[model samples]
Target: MDEAGLIERTKNPATRESLRRDLEGMGIGAGDVVLVHCSLRSLGWVSGGPVAVIQALLDAVGIAGTIAMPAHSAGLTDPANWGQPPVPPAWIEIIRSSMPAYEPATTPTSNMGAVAEIFRTWPKARRSAHPATSMTAWGRQEDEITARHDLGDPLGPTSPSGALYRSNAKILLIGVGFNRCTALHLAEHIRWPDRPSVREGAPILVDGERQWVEFEVPQIMDDDEFLPVGDAALASGVAISGNVALAPCIIAGMPQLVDFAVDHWRAAKHPATPR
Candidate 1:
């Protein structure tokens, strides 16, 4: 569908209400901290886009709730010199100047080019436990509903890419599933389900700095094997596959999610999110 059409369907009251019902039934509510993993394309928010979904989630949770999404943006230039590699000169300047200004709400853990303005407004949100493996919000910033554990594997310790749920943590697969879950990586870390595999290194650029960070990509699961399980995982949460292309309303909605996360996660925890 065209972008405008996507926006219209997304803003439809019937679709919105249907989505709200599905989410509420899946244990999303006030007083419950929820870490949402969403695909802006999956929700079909033609009118609202990613921002609308964020607002819908907040309304579901009410004042005493938390919501978060990944704002990671990394740039990789030189492979041989992983950590000390100089940042791409052009990207470096762009990130430092643009990210903070457009969206200044971010912790040190933010990915390349993610605007901090979104998260900075929400002082209390925790970064996701694993930023590299995260699709929404940094690992440390996720709400208490989902807890992350580090496996201690220097190469791929942050995210096991396995299926392991934490206390009170309900996996909201959204439009994607098991392959995308990265839950299996957690299992690989503990050696519970399958054998862990070694992976090659990749590059990424961080905001506000002129250096590149190298990452080791783990072979936790194969795409072919993960397809089926991923589909099953979707049943665990609300699954809406639609298009959303509207720019104005979505821009307005983005801030609400940011505000909700900061207030819920709190600012004191931002520094600790990356580690």
Candidate 2:
């Protein structure tokens, strides 16, 4: 939104300390492994924008805690599926063949927002190696959280999502919803009766040459059905609700969400659901 629109809607200016105070009050504490999805626009006018938000999150979790965010660089993926101003049909192949190799230090997050884009570049941050759907982390557990990102199952049991689940992590959504949760993708990967996979490719450096690599990942059609589960979680109080700075927030155990969602999905007999 434009500056004027932002000011008109978000009248308060939140600070790092204020944000930290709010987050801690909501139950995040020292040594927690938390995945965050925030919207700066929703936070109103922050004193330092994303920088302040990051500082608050780090402070809320303490030195021993870990913080993560989706760092997906989707532009590196197959241009054939592109939308939101997709490339011309004639230029798809040419662009895909020449796109720059995914570099952890240089690539930017597409559609995740300013907070994530800035957090991934923090001095102590470490990002997963997945070219198209990487996750970035900062803090004591950064290394473990970002390690071994499987190229094929970007959001499955082998990627950062799995790592977080195995470690009993938490997810904190600030002015966002389950549709962007990502942890739900892990639940989808463990289909009871098995599921199909989708083929995709991304540019990566191999043997000192940048090449487009093709692979099939578990087919995760959509999150259109995520609302019911999310609503249940919130209404049942399993997913805690509160405020971070000025924006509404939701916090929940990653495993609990996945388990709940898995049961809901399987019982629904909607084979097309989840991962």
Candidate 3:
């Protein structure tokens, strides 16, 4: 079928029903903890956009389960960059005003875009990250863990979003591909800790006050670009066979209980490689 036709099919109620069933078949039920990686555009429109997706996911898991998503915002001038080149004042204000404000708690950190704003409004949530990458979670909060190590760049590499991948942490990634996965870096740190100590201390401007923060972050290899990709076989392989398979599953009129986990590698660009 045509691309448009495929998108329409996946957005239909039939597709939603199938997705629900598929989720259940995959053992995503009550008491399970899942971390979702998503592109709202890829899912198309349901009765409610992201809100509906969150609700549907919650329902499938019932009251005892937990759902998580990544919510990150980058502030180039964040205290860590105090000595760096001055940033555009107006852009900094825009980011500051737009970022969601949450009462710090012991649960997961809340820092993704609109999703962060939505979850932050809920009580009993916390915000955590190394520097640039931020995520929100509920149930078995890791506030203490992140707070102890929230350091480095306020933007770019050292953002505070890397806390989601703590050692032996059980997480579920959804919708988005592996390349976008932010938690896998922690696994890399676990694998290698003595490599130039890339993690550093920085300052964050909060409530008109400069707050110093520290974090452990991955170093950029000579060929590295984009989000850091971990080589852990368990967390670093492609789940989707190709765009062809992903397109149909995302666009099909019904959902099937297929194993859809994947890790997208951020392979280095090599001019010598055959095109």
Candidate 4:
């Protein structure tokens, strides 16, 4: 929103302290592992913008805690799959050939919002090696969380989401929804082990040389497909709802939510089958 509109809607400028208090109220605390999906605009006007929000998260979690955010470079995907304002057919080859290799320190996130863009560059933050679906993490356990990102299983058992699940991390939706939750993709992988695969390509460094590589990954449902599961999560008391700043927020145990979604999807897929 415009600056004037944000100021008018926000009762007070959201500062680091206030944001930290709000986060703590939502049950985030020291040594907690949180996977955050946020929209800065939804938080209203802030004193320091994304910087303040990131600091507040750090303050809430303390040095013992760990924080992670999806740093996906979606634009690096094969241009052949581009849909939103798809490039001309003739330009596809040129686009793919010229696209820069994904570098953990230099590549920018696409459509991941301002908070994540800044968080990826935060000091001491470590990012996964996946060319298209890498995740960036900071604080304690950062290395463990971002250590093993497989090209063919970007959101599967070996990716950052898997690490978060293994660590019993909390999925924090700040001014966002479950559709933006990367954790749900893990559920999809678990529930559809035999799901069809899609061939995807990205530019990556191989032995210090840039090359476009192709790999097979399980096909995933669209973001909107997760909405029903999210609604069920809230209705079934799996997700705790609250507010941070002027934006609505929700926090849930990553494992609980993923398990709930798996069951929810299973029921829909096999309504007549006995559990």
User: What's each prediction's TM-score?
Assistant: 0.49, 0.94, 0.55, 0.97
The models' CA-based lDDT, in order, is 0.37, 0.85, 0.41, 0.92
**Per-residue lDDT of 129 in model 3:** 45
Model 2: runs farther than 4 Å from truth? 83-86, 269-275
What are the root-mean-square deviations of the candidates from the true structure over C-alphas?
12.3, 1.8, 8.7, 2.6
In candidate 3, what are the lDDT values of residues 22-109, reduced to their tens digit? 5565446676555555554445444454555565656666666555555554442243333345657665545444433322332233
lDDT, model 1, position 40: 48
In candidate 4, position 129 carries an lDDT of 99
- Over 4 Å off, model 4: 269-275
Q: Global lDDT for candidate 1? A: 0.37
Q: Candidate 2 residues 1-275, lDDT tens each?
A: 77688777765778999898888987899899999999888788888989999999999889889999999887888888777678799998898888999999999899999999999899979999999899999988888889898788798888999889987889999998888888878887764426777788899989978988998867674766577778878887779899876688899999998887777776775444534
Local lDDT at 100 for model 1: 27
**Model 1: per-residue Cα lDDT at residue 144:** 39
For model 2, which pairs clash? 188-275
Rank by lDDT, highest first.
Answer: 4, 2, 3, 1
Q: If both were scored by lDDT, which would come out higher, candidate 1 or candidate 2?
A: 2
Q: Pick by TM-score: which candidate is best?
A: 4
TM-score of 3: 0.55
Candidate 4 lDDT tens digits, 1-275: 78899999988899999999999999999999999999999999999999999999999899999999999999988888878979999998998899999999999999999999999999999999998899999999999999999999989888999999999999999999888999998998888877888888999999999999989888888887787789899999999899999889999999999999889888885421111
